[model samples]
Target: MAVVLLLLKTVGVLGFISLLIFYLKKIRLYRAAAKFPGPPALPFIGNAHVFVGSTEDILNKIMELLDTYPSPLRFWLGSRLFFGVCEAEQLKIVFTSPKTIEKEDLYKFARPWLGTGLFTAPASKWRVHRKLILPTFNPRILESFVEVFAQQSEIMVRQMKVEIDGDEFDVFNYISLCTLDIICETAMGVTMKAQTEGDPTYVESAKRTFEIFYTRMFKVWLHPDIIFNNTRLGKDQRECIDYLHGLTNDVIKKKKLELTFDSPIIEDTKPRKAFLDLLMELSNEGKKFTDEELREEVDTMMIAGNDTTASVNSFVMLMLANFPEVQEKCYQELCTIYGANINTDTVITHEDLHRMEYLERTIKETLRLFPVGPVLVRYVSEDLDIGGHVLPRGSSVVIGILKMHRSEKYWKEPLKFDPDRFLPEEVAKRHAYCFVPFSAGPRNCIGVRYAMMAMKTLLATVLRHYILKKDRTVRIEDIKLKADVMLKPVEPISVKIERRKH
Candidate 1:
């Protein structure tokens, strides 16, 4: 009886002490946050509850706050208070100003997958990888990949073969499938054939990865027990992540085995132009990227290059379907440059790609409406001040990209879908960094040029063959979204397409 009574007393005492500590922390946070602008947060939970389910809502909150709050809105996540940085002038401070915001914890989630690569690697490793892999983005590689992209794009055109009076069929899947194949073909020297094959391994894994990605980001809201135990998101995420690891391991194993017998791997066997081949060649020379290192880049390329870019292309088609006049302009632009005889056999060259300026503007507008990476996060390594607020070290600051895009000061009719805003003169008038679909600074997407070329080539090849119209089922505004890693349409985006009889 005495032992049981003692145990109960001990439990009560521990609970009391924890409560005391929590209250003390909250008092200190309240005092620290008095100088900044934000909604009052409760003791332990913080403001994570304000924006749930969709990051679009979080983006909306950030947007509302951006116009009202100064550049930095001091907010809390548990006991830690962070100053969210938004203004373009301040972006230079955080991204370029080496001393203040030296570390990036935004991509910490990716560390498990893409360890110490250009994306999230430490300063020293980043320098080495950045320099060594610099040649991958060279003109030679870009040119070679363009040829590969054009070839795959032509194959895409050949795959679509149905005719009807002006009508719409689901083409988002088609574009996604093509890009999926293109990335693999160019990067891995493997053909996915996702368009022709109904259930391709790579494409399925890519889609599943997005779902898993959303779960990882979204589950931050629920109570720890709810999130980890007896939840669909948590359970399924493990399987998907495991599958991704398995795929990368398989690819790495294949590459290593090929390297043993063949000098260039591609030269002795297939002569295929692949990122793996280039990395292997460099490894053979002197710079050997370990299996894990190569896996990091390969996984990054798969997710970054495939999922987000495809989502934008899907939205672009949806926009084109809505505005036939814009589609007409894009078509006319292509016809003027490529001429009347363009068909499945047409090989789109790198120089020819530069001429399609109208298509480029349309894509820019699409990116504006549905920015793939809406929020950019950075970790403060030291105390910093910007736009009248002081941010301490280890604060996870998020830049609201979507809100900035739609800000009244920078954009007129911020919600409207207008391609003319991106005209050479108009674009020049705006701040250079205002339009950042690929982000900025040292961590900006390296595949921006590759994505643009692929988007243009495929748009040229596909739109030329079909008249695209929006399906009645999926409207422009109402198309639901799962806002997590990359914002994606919740349902399969459908567009009706009729073959253009020449």
Candidate 2:
């Protein structure tokens, strides 16, 4: 009886000590985070409640917070504290800092789907991988892809032609499928035919995977592997991941059998090497990227290359539809480039893409309003000073691109969609990091040139053939946005496309 009593007392003492340590750590974090302005946080839970809502509601709440708080604001998600910065000066320190290159814990949600690909890998591994992949996106490589872009764009134009019966439809669906086909052909050397086909398993799996990851991010209860795996959402996530992996593996296997290392093939005479072929060549040489590494990169490129460009294309189309004047200007620019003979069959060369300067600006302005990734999150590796606040190590820093883009200080008539904001004179006056659609810094999107080529090619082709008009008049303020892995509109962007009178 005495021994039992002593054991109970010992257990109680240890538990008390553990509780004390936890509270002490919390106190320390609170003191450091106290320096920044933010919404009041509760003990233990912090500001986690703010994140509990539908994706659209969560986005609205975040926008509200951005309006209320100053730059370098602090917020806690359970015990973890995050610093949110939306000003250009503050962003410069975050993006350009060599030490702050690591992505935040929030990116871990993508691990199951992407593995440790370029997007989610550590700074050290990212450097090596980035060096190897840089050549894959060179101007020559991207120039070769113009044909693929033009071909796929023609397919998209044909598809749109079938729908141009003076009726409105969600433009995102067609555009997303077209991008899926483009990425598959250029990145994997496989034609998914997603544009012609209703919906392929690979495309569906990718979409489901992103949606699952987005859900896991905001819902704290769904974070732990043991608990999540047991749930229906978790099971769905695993199946989708497996399906995507299987599809990529099949593509990789087929490509390996066809490529030969010894052959010194001429660039023009031989077929153009896909991005996967380039990666395989690196592996064939002494600088070997393992099969797993290859898979990660291929998967990353497939997902990243498809969805982001698709979102931008859809948004740009929507913008053009809503503003007829802007659409007319873009059409005029296209007319100058192609002359009166411009048709759906027009082949868009690299030189032709550059001449659509106004259209490029419009794409930039669209990105400013609706950045594909609304927020860029990084893991603070070392103690840093941002906007006079001494941010301690081991905290997450979120750069709110949406907030920064629309901030009154950096933009004139920030809410209005003005392509002139990117004009030479206007651009020169603004901070270099102020307009980062593809992000800025050493880790900025490696696919920037490829995406631009694709967007310019596709948009130029579509505008040449049709006049896009909104089906229903919708104001920018009325359109609701959702905070997923990517920024998405709650309602589909429906537009009416009319055949141009040649």
How do all models score by TM-score?
Answer: 0.88, 0.96
**TM-score of candidate 2 to 2 decimals:** 0.96
lDDT by residue for model 2 (253-339), tens:
887766643345543355687899899889989657888889999999998888899889989999999899899999998888888
- What's the lDDT for residue 409 in model 2? 87
Worst 10 residues of 2 by lDDT: 260-269
Full-model lDDT, candidate 1 = 0.71
Alpha carbon lDDT at 342, candidate 1: 55
Model 2 lDDT at residue 21: 95
**What are the runs in model 2 whose C-alpha is more than 4 Å off?**
1-11, 260-268
Identify the leading candidate in terms of lDDT.
Answer: 2
* lDDT digits (tens) for residues 183-251 of candidate 1: 877777776677678555666665665555544443345335455546675565566667877877886
* Residue pair clashes in candidate 1: 168-495, 168-496, 168-497, 169-495, 169-496, 169-497, 170-495
lDDT of each: 0.71, 0.86
